[model samples]
Target: MKQEQFLSVVDRDEAERRFRAALEPLGPLGVEEVALAGALGRVLAEDIASPVDVPGFDRSNMDGFAVRAEDTYGASEQAPRRLRCLPEPVVMGVLPVGEVTEGTAMAIPTGGVVPRGADAVVMVEHTRLDGDHVLVEKPVTPGRAITWAGTDIAQGEVVLRAFDVLSSRETGVLAAMGVDRVGVVRRPRVAILSTGDEIIRPGTPPLPGRIYDSNQVILADAVREAGGEPVPCGITPDAPEAVRAALLDALAVADLVLLSGGTSKGPGDLNVQVLAEVLAPPGILAHGVALKPGKPLCLAASGRKGVVVLPGFPTSAIFTFHEFVAPVLRILAGRARPARLHGGEADGARTWARLPVSLGSDGGRTEYVLVRLTEDAEGAAIAYPIGKGSGSVTTWSHADGYFVIPREVERVEAGERVEILPVAGVRPRRVDLVIIGSHCVGLDVVLARLAQRGVSSKLIAVGSEGGLAAVRRGECDAAGVHLYDARTDSYNTPFLEGGLVLVPGYGRLQGVVFRAGDARFEGREAAEAVRAAAQTPGVVMINRNRGSGTRALVELLLEGTRPAGYAVEASSHHAIGAAVAQGRADFGVAIDIVARERGLGFLPVREERFDLVVAASRVERPGVRALIDELASEEVRAALRGRGLLA
Candidate 1:
């Protein structure tokens, strides 16, 4: 059968509008009563009512004697009153044997039942224990120490609202209400597959021009976080038949089948083309999107299986999933978006106060820059960007929330405060992390990995000396630096000698980036284009800002020459390759490993040591300790392999 194709291919926005318009609320998918102890992070399907009154009876909050309020009306500490303690007021949960007349008292313990005739409970601290009876010296008032039945919870009252995601407190509340089980929404099962021959698993060593498969790991985490049960089906070949089989198999057990990679319009796009043919008619709803990074998305409904084809890149995959799939699955599970304060995007307001730290722009697309925020002495919020540029998955890890700068404008200058929307909450606590040195590609990767290990790290790509200054001022927890002392040929230590201790971290490699089959060719001939790139008009040279290890390396490679004034200077290593990938830049300075991943060419440059430095006081912090261990792990070295910096 011939594959079905599209009529009008629109962009990301139109695709979202179409897909969202077609979504219908999942009708009563059924529910299960999960144990209260196991209900944390689960969405409550309905309002759970209290079957019975909490406490069930009038109870004493303290010990001593239960007495009538009228009997002790004139009693006081100085003018104390003594009352005879009655022996028979019945135990808790049992009816009183005999009701006492007024002017009498009975001994009661904390949480003990208050007899029917007693109006209040007096603590034992206020009574004297005599031979066979207790004497009350303090006055008692009606309902002073009594908790009336149904006071804590009313009968058949709604304890938790429907569509509420349960937190630990909610679970505890359910348990307190004597609920053993509760009905919760069913978790949607999603199957994920990483495609492309060039992508390998992290455990596998790279061969020739190949790289590790990180899409599965990242996408899986994002899925689980978004309330889906992710089933990673591992990496598959680029062949259309293999992809088809994987989708069919995943369709059997999953509500959604997500295939990563092979969506780009290159020769590899055969998978997308094949999907159109195989899942045609009532199947493929839309292919390609208006979204920036994840523009080449695919959405289809085949039988009971809904397929979402995401871009192979990590950040794009994450963004698209959050914006699209997450909302849908949450709807299916009867979930509501948690109330958060976005403060909306900036309006006509000019730059407010100083932004605490400097930040970059989003170019044209809607940008999300995760930031760490803190209040100043006057309690005003100060946003510190973890880093700009979404390509590095790690930046998202280190950020508390991203300060949004929408597409219509150009840039937010230094000291110009902006509204930073948090990744988690509107008022996230200030995390203590100090990142120093040049901003390179995927430095956020290192931060992301650190976060997975349970660290609340924040990154600021300050220069080497700049980081040292921040360290001396006690502003950051740890600073990342790759500053080279030409005399000693080492990184960070010399600058931080008096202020902090430099911890040797693994090295990441730097190289010149170009597209494949460029006329520039290889070796020394490649240098001709590389050397003249800065001078060449319309040429974009993505580089780490001055003081970065990458910039240092670039200067070392160019020797006495500077970037030709005609070239465009990009902010980061990933931005460089990204610029080159979509043809924004002709060539840029970045790591060799990334060049291969984005289908770009690499021109080798010098290497530098990326170091993590901590103040003397923070050496014992758990986050820093865990980081040291990770930096020393075989897994990290394996991940770093041939990146510019050395271990």
Candidate 2:
């Protein structure tokens, strides 16, 4: 085949369809019987029909008197019906030996076997016992308090379907059905190989120009996360014979093989050419991709086994594996394709969060933006872009998830909502409202009120400026802000524009926060204490981030002077208070609530107004409306009262 055939970079959708068709004939893994105790998280290999009925005998649902239904007719509180009680009460796990005849009753405990000829049970609470004579006050209809045989699970019924992922609930069902062993699909074996001459394995001494083989470990873990058994083949040096030998060995034992690195069109790249030579005609289905960071992707298949050549970069290799490899693994392991919109929430494992900053993408190819989640002091989650390089290891540590920017979208403006697919270890949350900016403890009350109304919200602390910016871009439902204008001697609305609507949030007392026995503030006024702190040598002054309202106020108080630690910044009031409390700093500016909560001394700076800014377009959303109403509710006001944040 000509090299030109492999040069054309196919689109992701086209590549996906081709790979799916190619791997379709591979079929599911062979079935094996596993002990019910060991089958958790494994897919069922076949439908399991119960061999016997669950709770195979008729039983009482409650501790009561089991009797003929006709005997309890017309029994009431005012007018009671009397019956002869049996000598002994039937306890749980004990079967009643005697049958209840006409006008006779027997005490039956919950889950106790029902005696013959008993049609219903009258709750013991509804009856009074008088020396073997029972007075019934209420009547239970036939079959009302008794669970008939086979009612919970019928005999020979299909209790579990093929391809179902078994969890504790399924295990319990199996145990209840008396199935000690269950047929489950064997985990597909995936061979992971890293190929490159410059690649060095982990635990080796660092050498200049030599990179560690991180892709192998990443791919191995990814395969395991997707329910496949990983067989690590280690590193294969970039030689055709060595590559071919590794490929053949992997194919012999692995249902799927992943070769990371050496896929680019550069001189060292040889995975596609070697695959073509080894598999011969009609083996390499697709080569190259129209995706950023993953353009070097290659797909190949030999008989029932498949091979994927992932890009060299860590992020690109991970991205491509999830896009192409995970689905193939799922199919081979007898796991059904998760029903969802393409690139949408997978199996409903998605949470919507507002973008803190604008994201841009070329209109031609799909782009994934790495992001990290942050919660505001009020606990709403906000997502912000993280490191951009596909090879940056920091993304693995910092990012919680990634959101796909569709091919047609040129830019996702700041504050625009985006769907995020979470990283493996991070559990995803469903976000109802994206509230960005200013950290306020008072908002916690609003959150509780919103939760009581069954509304979910996510708060991202980006400071007042960041919140206002997000609101301006329409990325969030609202932004909590406490911007103070020195010129106007006012707060919040001074920074607002006509495109936004401000809803009154609360009033917070800004103050100087210091440790309990700090001498800098001893018997000094708010302004004098601040001046003394500046003058006192070796006293560290913690500051808030640049965009925060508290930082702005602190700057105003200093007036063009640089304190010892003015460059050092904390993101929230809690952080500032923590620095002071832990002796990391002598004093810092924070809200009164934080000072009180941290048991620190406080000196009042100024009371500032905090409010939520909403885009005109978002005011009508149900969550936005609920929040507005909640803020106005007396519950929020009462909670905010005396906390120096009363609305």
Candidate 3:
């Protein structure tokens, strides 16, 4: 079988233009009458006007006596004025029977209809009852303590406009207008299908060569989040007949069809082929896009109904769905588009942020880098790239937003400003503490403790040297460092300069890590194991990134011998342990905590001091003070000790 190639590869803007042109003049599907009880989260289909005036009639706002204003105009505590009191008392929800004439008053409850000839209401506390007459001690003005008819809501006034989303507040307004039902736009029905021979249901046991179908679950919820109803069509195999029947069924029952997988340029990729045969006029607007993580996307339409084929990769599928499909879904469901910040129209759904490190792009494709947002000491936003590729499933969940690199640009220099677009449904918030430095598992316990005390923190792992540089620039409140000084033979104190304070943190046992049963490293000393691994042929040893204290230690242990896989540098201790545990490398250096966590064998080298370096100007910050206080607490010390750190 021959692989089917893309009909055309176009830029993102051109692809979006072609797709929208194919499905022009999009609007809501239709309208339906829904009870007010079930109207939450629904968009109004038509303008709603009040049926009757709110409050319906003039009413008293407090429990008081209704009387003519002249009767109480000159009344005072020293010289009380007397008035004749009516026999009947006014009750709530009922109209008063008698009128209040000159020098006359009647008892009225709150919310009771005001009687004719009454111009004001006097509080019961200010008046005294004497037989059938009332003595007024306080002065009153006309229309005082009274709510006039139609004052809250006037009749024939539009209360809600079309396309307004109904919340609790909106529903309350409709209820006050005596409306039992409302006309709301119908939710668009979307059908989701997953295709692949390697796809299996989530609850089933894992097989040797199969993966669970996560795209279906992700797309189903995403459709609902975009205000569309999802109709799930179960997974289909690679067989042509099975996929064709599934596509036809989905098209017949859904207003839009989404098929993930089988859109790339592989012989087994046949969803696009099947879609081309079924779509009507103006079919297959664009087959491939010039964007990273979403280049294999295919867009098509059957008259007004849209059919999209998403890439099989989770990140690619989700990115394309939001960039292309979500906007159309919002229009069909009568939902408003998201608002962009002022002066950002050219960037389109993006805001400005500072990138801390340099990044390289593919040059041929527009790359979107997912980032986690944090703040500097001066409260400016910084975007740290996640660095995980498109195949990673956890990137979407962990990312705060993403920034794009254009196809023409190949590299973004450090400290360069870039425009970031927020992830759907994620609102970035300012954190209380910003810690930039090496990653540690024990730090998680400390941050968790801070969270219990209502402090939010953001940690960026950029190595010890980078963190020290950031501290000098006042880019962070504090930085965690574990730099070893060869001259002074100290861990962190020797590295501190003027205006920088050293906060004693904890010690971690750095060691050589390997698989538990690997005979080459299990029971040997740290230096001996490292030397043996470096000398042995085909014994791969993973190294840490430059500027890290662990990398310095690795260089010392290697003694100038570059072993296999020495160039493969990882960013964190966990990544080093993962490489050795997964057989990607024979040995690596990490902390004892990581080895214990990953169930790997450890040979201790030396205990390294991990301490905090604080900027002198930011030492008095509330978050920094709180962090210092927590570090001195016995609870934190105990927790750190439990996690294999010497606190």
Candidate 4:
């Protein structure tokens, strides 16, 4: 078969519009009766009204004597009133056998039925038992210590409404109403199919040029989480006949069909073709979507049933499934959409976060950038991009939430505000202290010490300049910086503004890092090796990100000459070491600690003072105070020195 081209490409919103339009007026598949014990997580099909009053009759709320108020009106400790004690006592779940008439009383326990002529119950402590009579010392009022019928729940009152998800609390209410079985909306059956010639089931011995089918496993659980019953359709090889058969079998037993792979414009892409032949009217409403990580997604409908073809990559498949298919499945299963997706700002489910780094986007497609959220010193959210591409399988697991970049916007600047859409119904957890700036192993030591004192902190590595900016904006309690000012020939202090206070951190030796045993850098003076590497032909050098202290040092060393890989920037010292050690680049500037950890050859250039720039207003805050105290502690200082930092 010839390679299939996309018939149409629409933006994400337009694609969703066409897909939902094809399957309009969606609702629950049907309702079914489920026992109360099995109703947890099921959506109620209709309102449940109480069949009878909670308390069938007037009952006693205390273990005391039941008597008319007038009979004990004048009874007191000084002068007591005597009454004949009835032989029969009221017991729980049993009807009272005798009546207390005129100057007579009967003992009744809690939840015991109240007898005729008894309007009140007195405490056993207040009454003294005699041979044939009881002495009442406290006055009694009519209807005291009594629980009237229907007091807890009235008859015919709606206790639970339609579409309410049954939890322990709701189930307890249903049990109290004597509802053993209840009607609930049926969970939609979702058919999951993973198609590819190179796909193999997990646990089947390894094979060359083949991968385990993880899409099915993830999609199945995702369907269940979205209130649908997953029906695994197994793997289908890249053949028209086999693909067609699998598609038919899936549709035969499912309300929705989800197939990953074979939707792109490759020669092996035949799932969309098979869907085109099998789907009824309004088939293949959208063949392509203008979205990053999910542009090849296809949405369709066969009469009332929904069909979706997700991208082949694991991250892409799951992302598109949640964005497009999960909402439809939730609607069909009688569950409401997540409040973060549709609710207003007042919902408390949404948060606005500032990006710590600028992001470049593909202007042709709307991109959703996954981020890890951390709170600032002022309790504001800071979003850090995961930066892993869509093909990666681990990005989704570590992401806290994601923010959207519109197709018209090509870049988002550092510290720009954006609304964060929470993932899996999880909101950003607030932390006690927020530390943003350059990263160092010594900072980790101090943070660990603070943790022992029950203090929590969040650290965002955005280079020295970026961190200082965050501190100036009042977004962070402290910033770690090692900036060297050429004018003053000093570090950190030269960059501090009036409102910022410099806290003594530690000193780290910054040096040129190269692969161990590289003759060009081994056993040479730091200045001589740097000069030799800069002038050497065909020598590639990894550069630090702009605004970092190391970047400034790099520029000074190069003397206005850009190397082969000068534009390729890494954000952290560890990344630089890794690049040099792995042969991605010949050399980069990083801390000596990273060189030692990654087993790279290091030529020390100079020791830079790494200090914390604290916001003066936040210096007295509890978390900040704890962080300062930890920094000054002997244990923390010893740990920092052990990590090759001069404390």
Candidate 5:
């Protein structure tokens, strides 16, 4: 891979342009004729015209007696005009063989053909039937109860326009209009290929840095979402010869090809080289975007076929798929790709509160940080970041939606509030992850694992003191802390003091957590709020409530340092982090673990033994035991890494 020719890296806009330009040369799949029944979900390829009126002759619209309006003039319940009953009857789907001569009535049901000389039909319900006779109870009007010809659909009218989707209702319309066949647009077929020596098939054991391929599956999903059929051309080890052969073969059967991985100028530059070779003089439309995660992108095409290559990173690849492929998919399917996910309701949740959580984003690109969202006490939206790293696959599984940070902004200062567009289909109320002490870096790993098992858990990283308070108040499922119980010479015992039972779990080192880069500089030991928004109107303070171990520790450090009536509360470590991020109140108290993942400024409060407290009544519950078991697993220790309260 000759050091991958030096090409200037462009940004997101350039990347999209290159990609779209590559795909533009291929023509859309035109209309194909098929049986009406088979075109149920396909797009209409041509207009359909009805040759005859929906009903060629006047017909009965209801089941009633038919009569001339003139014969019933002034005839009402007050004074009825009874007509001699003519010996005639009509049924649905059939034309009358004889006519009711002038001044005579005929019995006809709904949809029956109108008889000669019959001008109107009265409801059978509205009239009484006597032996060989019928009495009209209401006034009869001319043309009443009779459906005129061409009422539903007129002759020579276009029933379906070209490019319209053939819904069941649309299909029924054609059937009613006497159409036995339909013309539909052909479904675009896409060949999905995964290329790379480092990519492994799903379920295969990984070797060192090698990883199971998820890009292809995600890309295929993108293809399907775009209204194209995914042929799943499968994985091929990266070799220029192999890449060229596979691409050539895919082009023979596919309208387009989606290749995941190898868009970057890594050791596997074979994709770039081979695509350029196969695509002709103007091949390799573009390579290398300026976006943070997906910068290593590639686009290439010839007159007959096109190829879109995405970087190996899962999140980047997914984003790129939506960026480049989704539009084409819609065009080929002859429908617009929906901008919003299904099952979403118009959210009235405009008010949001800053909870104790940090934000991360790659520099130079608008990074989309995935988060778990929940509502606060007042039903305000609150978001917490999912652990992030381009390589962290867990972020994808745990996130409900993503928060976008604009380019070159490297950091989302803790407490700086932002909106999140949630992934559709999320039920925020079903979350179960609740941790009471300092937020941790890898807690998101636990969330992802839980999600993998089909569980939705909300991570509540409240501080050690907040944990105890929450546990006492029944605000959460579990609490973690490393509180020094001087009387017991142990961690967390005195915090439990009485009512709650401690569930045995492994121990973690707990302390102040700060941004990865701020590892060395410990900021001011105390925290304060710049302004108060909701709990009070004008005043704000980094105050603590009665139950927090962090507050107790803070009180021990500076006697009565908390301002009078300044007892403005921070609900958890995350809430405290928010206070700090927004400069709301002078430093409040918290452990270090929760602050580390956000790249925030953190001051170590103290080391505490993090523990989970089960309500006395809940101690024996199976779910409680399960919590304890999971806490004891190796995964928990991984979760505890860099969390504020760990000692």
Candidate 6:
């Protein structure tokens, strides 16, 4: 058989688009009617509007006399009012026989229907039974203690929208809406097939050079978590005929099919070839992806069925399933995207977090970095990078989450954040403080102090301008900014907009950072060193992103001459240092603390005031207050001064 191969390894975005396009024709799974008691986790196929009011009739919410509210008006213990009594009180299982007229009252119990001419119910405790009348002591207002018709739920109101996953709570809602059986999307059936000859079931004894199948169990549970039904198609040896037979069986009973192993280009690997030849037209959509662990991923579709060829290695299989298969399964199952929890209390509910250490990756390919999350001594959640080989299954069990490094980024600096999709069932701390803006070493110190107070902050390094824009749009609680206004010769305060209060932060020593012992900076002053470096041949200059205060100063120092590698932009000051330290560039602009940490020599250019700008209204909020107090505290100052970056 002719082996099928990838046309080109596409990036994550293009891969997603192709998968989505292929699955678009599958549409929603066929609808099925499920009893309310068994509807948990099922997605609704139709809007469930209430057919009738929940109570269905006007009823009493309290055991008291039902009378005109005006009769009890101004009635008090000191000056009691009396009303004529009815022959009998309102009874359960029977409506009131007669209405209470002026100066008349009737006894009513909880859940009893209210009679006509009565607008309120005065509790029995507030009234005393007399020979032929009841004496009221407390005042009662109209509609007091009375639950009117349709109070619980209104008729024709859409209680549940289509495609809503039915939680236990939602099932209760359906019950309340008088829906006994509901139409819901059928659980997507996922067929799993292992196609390697060296694989055996878990119960079987291991043989030399052979392993038990773990992908089936792992992938099956993953499908269940995403609201799909997994059907194990059993294992097939590495043969074209066997693989093809298993796939056809899977396609017969499954909405989606996953064939593990046999995807790589080898004589024994025939899953890709089978998918291309045996599957319906538009056979193989993608044969490979630019994904790190799951680079050998293969995708195909036949009519309404989608098939994915997964790598045999457990770690790679899991990663590929999560990154590629889970999302499409959710679409077929009609699961809505989970909402992000807001507020500090839900801080442990976010899917991703800030990277505490720098992570390096090759550009142009999406890399999934495995990570383990641990709370530091201060109770702040920290994600430590794990770089075990993709073939090692232990990496999956050890990882709390994994972060996807984009194709455009080569390195993520310490304190430069990333989103971490947790392992199937892991929950992370909620981001207590959201700071979107310029990255600074001094701010990192302040964050460390906050961590000591058990507060977690998420920092996004998007330059000073982006931070300010985020603050303006109310996207974040605060932003770290150090924008230098050339006109005013001042920093952050000059560029402050309305609704934002500039909190004065410590000044940082901005300078040129270069590799140690570089001859260009041996004795030259800061400005001269920069000019010399720019004019020298083979000298590469790394720079911070435009709109950064440090970048502004670098431009000021450059005057007009452009340097080699000027087009290369680093996300943060630490990134600049890391770039130069790694020999990716000759020199770059950054702060002193970061330069020293990377063992790079620094030449002081000027002190830039790095301020924290917050929404004026959030000044008293807990996280913002902690940030303000920590920044002004002596501990933060001492830590900052120790690094020689504090002013």
Cα deviation in Å at residue 115, candidate 6? Answer: 1.7
The whole-model C-alpha lDDT of candidate 5 against the native structure comes to 0.60
lDDT by residue (1-647, candidate 5, tens digit) is 65243276766777666666656543347877898878777877655666555555566777887775567667666566667677857767777766565456788877787765565788877677667666677776655666545444444444455555665657777777778888787888999888887778888776887888887788777776666788988889978888899988888899878887776557765777777777754567667767767777776676645677877788988887777777777677765422211222335333343534465556899877667665433445556665433332234545556667899788776557777665554433434345555444334444444433333344544456656665665545666654666466577777676668886544433333333333123443332211111133322234444455555555554454433224445444554544444333334455453355334555544455545676675555443454666666776655555332232
Give the runs in model 4 whose Cα sits over 4 Å from its true position: 1-7, 69-83, 136-144, 206-208, 337-647
What residue runs in model 6 are displaced by over 4 Å at the alpha carbon? Answer: 1-7, 203-208, 336-647
Q: List the residue pairs that clash in candidate 4.
A: none
> Each candidate: how many clashes?
25, 6, 0, 0, 47, 5
Q: After superposition, how far is residue 84 of candidate 5 from its true place, in Å?
A: 2.2
Model 2 poorest ten-residue lDDT run: 339-348
lDDT (10s digit) by residue, model 2, range 1-647: 24654688899899877777776665577898899889988998876766764556666878889987778889999888999998876777776778777799999988887776666889889999888799999987766576545445544444566666776657777887788998899999999988888999899999998999999888888887788999999888888889989988888898888998877657776777788878733587788878887888898888657888898899999999998899778767876433311233223367777766677777999988877665442445567876324422234434568889989999999767888787765554444567877757687667756654546566655678988987776557899998888899889878888878999888888889888877778557888787766777666687777888887799877776676557556666765765576554678898887777668999888888889999887788777888899889887898889555756
Residue 625 of model 4, lDDT score: 84
TM per candidate? 0.51, 0.50, 0.52, 0.51, 0.49, 0.52
Question: What is the Cα-based TM-score of model 4?
Answer: 0.51
Cα shift from native, residue 107, model 3 (Å): 1.9
Give the Å error, residue 504, model 4: 69
Better of 1 and 2 by TM-score: 1
| Tens digit of per-residue lDDT, candidate 3, span 531-571 | 88899976878788899988888988899998866766766
lDDT of 3 at 303: 88
- lDDT tens per residue, model 4, 497-568: 898999888889999999989999899987778778888975768788788888888887888887656756
- Which of the predicted structures, 4 or 5, would earn the higher TM-score when compared with the native? 4
The residue-level lDDT of candidate 2 at 542 comes to 75
- Per-candidate alpha-carbon RMSD to the true structure: 31.0, 27.6, 32.4, 31.9, 29.2, 27.0
Pick the lDDT winner: 3
Q: Local error of candidate 3 at 428, Å?
A: 16
When 2 and 3 are scored with lDDT, the better candidate is 3
